[model samples]
Target: METLYRKYRPKRFSEIVGQKHVKTLFINSIKNNNVSHAYIFAGPRGTGKTTIARILSKSLNCENRKDAEPCNVCNSCISIDKGNFMDVLEIDAASNRGIDEIRKIRETVGYHTAQGKYKVYIIDEAHMLTREAFNALLKTLEEPPSNVVFILATTNPEKIPQTIISRCQVIDFKNIPLKDIVDRLEFVCQKEKFNATKDALIEIAKRANGGLRDALTILEQVAKSSKNNIDINDVRNTLGLVSEELIDNLLKNIKEGNIINILKIIDEVYYSGRDFETFLFQTIEKILLLIEENNNTEFINLLKPLSDILKDIKYSEEKIILVKLGFLNLINFKENNNKTTNKVLENIKKESEKIEENIESEKTEVMEKDIPKFDEVLEDLKINGDLSLYIGLSFAKIQEGSDKIKLIFPYSKKLHFELIKDKKSFLEQYIKRKFGITKEIEVILSNSTEDETLKKLSFLFGKNYKIEGD
Candidate 1:
């Protein structure tokens, strides 16, 4: 069966959605009988460049037409629609993009149409054609061939030579509007008898990102998987889309420096079968919005790590690792730059003599507890035959807290930290069994040693990151 994009493709000029500007120009050109012999249709993909080209081909040759529109009943329109018309030829310039192919067209430019007055040539992805081929085609486009009409469609018009561009009527096509895309999806739902909710169709349209063809393709995939019944959940499941709610919550957590919730959300997104790149891309766009409104430096810092994850995404099979690590980097950047939290910590630290005296008294007693030290955990990992985990965590500096074991790593030990963090459960289990400490295991990245600022950093951030004081 033909896909929805093919099956529901616009068969007439009036039926095409969006590109009112292109349609308006072409209508006046055709009505005036002054259509250019050579034309360029430049736009993004799925924006109906090729569709309009074919429709225009029909209008140029239709035996019976009404106001620059094809009648669709004539032998000309039927044969063109069925892809058997001799006068209408579509060339995929990506594959046949050389001088030899251009020479072939140059040879046949003057031949009489088999059954129509105009012989139309549509070159799709015309930008992929070699410079030599474009130069060769320029010769033909420059003169003669009164019965021939050439339409070149490309996503990249800037690559075409300026001399060639000067010889053609360039009709730039914009992306279809969101409302138009949704309305079309609704029409498809009605005609195809697909029981899709309005919100579901809107979700599909948004996912399509202003491409009507992409919207219909997504709708059909969800429709087929749903047997023509689609809802928001079906669209989410079919497209593996992270919900807007989750995406919003994630950015909120990043801004607030909520490490635990951020990790939890990453788990939710990963288990929902969402693609890592999609999830990261959505978050980056939202962060960009936040940075734009607030002009906040911390939010801007989050983008570098998020973008780094996008590049690193292809290097690993388990994407959850990169996502979790990237967000951890975000949390670190956020918390370390939190002026409000650090200010409170500074005031508290100023009067620390009393608290320090109190803490010093309890510190002795707390130290007597069976809390695990970082070295003992490493020793336990080694003894338990986890040599890789033992070796990976071996480089971390030890900081034993009253109720936790803190492991610190430098920037150079990032891979080691990631490896150890990935196996936190196993390491936690080993420490609990061997050391009798029910304490949580915390991992962090920092370049500072045990000092006053490090302690403030610990207070500002969550348990995932810890910095100690002497």
Candidate 2:
């Protein structure tokens, strides 16, 4: 039985999935009658390079083509689909990569298309052509007969000679997007009368990893494996892949610093035939995500120990000495009945607590000492010489024996409050460095009477001054 991907292979340019930019270029070339004599389509396999080449061939030969698209009703289109078209030749270079093959192709250049205006040569896996074969074809490619066109397709274009590349116009095809793959798979399911869930289709698509052929192959395998509607479990079981839930649980155990639990989960997975390397890779990925959440520093710190443990499990031996050390530690772990692991974990917890406490103590000290004897802070501001600028600058009112310091600025409205909020860190850092203190500073906006403002300013600047009430 034909597989879904092969059965539903795109029959025309419009049916080709992804490669929109390449499609546009092809369409415009056909529209403008500016087709190149030789072309190279290069990218990953199953990205529809050969399909597009065939479509372009049909469009060029069709008796009635519309906007460079093949008119499927035409005899040319039908014959091309059946691989019986004399005008369009599809050669598998992998099987015919000798100089003799190139010689045969060169010999055929004299004859024009039997039923069409041009003869098209589509060489699949053109990179497989031998060096001598490529050399034999280069001259023909450089100045091909007016009625002949060449379309060379390869997944590994780099293997082809640069001289050959320079002789042709290149179009790079890309891997199909996940959504496009899912949409196409859904269409296949509908056409085949097979029951499939959206999630099941998505899983198949993801497993394909941007290859439509792989996606279809997986879909076919799943359809045969299941009697009814395809479910997530069926897909997982069929693929022999681990569940996301298992991955999540493994991560949770690691994050909780439960080394025994993590090792148990690993053992379960390993014994169940899950790939240990894949588990390690997934754990690394989860740790990276945890690190990305900058607002949760505690979570980041917790994940660091897990990442360290993973790093110790040597998967390779270019660093064999380190791996030996890690294995020795693991062996010793078994002998000690996890006592060492428990002690290490306890130390980690104590370190985390110490870090938190240090932060709190620093905040307290900043609050206590950051508010200078109002006079000294005011003198520094004046020496820096900006009375007008300082007029609206906010000042945090410090209360004796309190951890909080509140800012007071009357001349400015809420703008000062907003600025203070935004610059709170900068202000705190500046105060700590300037005053050698470690306490939290809080900003508060308040309107004081004129007499109060003047008296405060005089006290702050250490100058005798009288204030008249407004």
Report RMSD for candidate 1: 21.8
Ten consecutive residues with minimal summed lDDT in candidate 1? 362-371
Superposition-based RMSD of candidate 2 using all C-alpha atoms, in angstroms: 14.7
Clashes of 1: 0
* TM-score, predicted candidate 2 vs. hidden true structure: 0.63
| Alpha-carbon runs more than 4 Å astray in model 2 | 275-470
Cα distance off (Å), candidate 1, residue 222? 0.4
TM per candidate: 0.69, 0.63
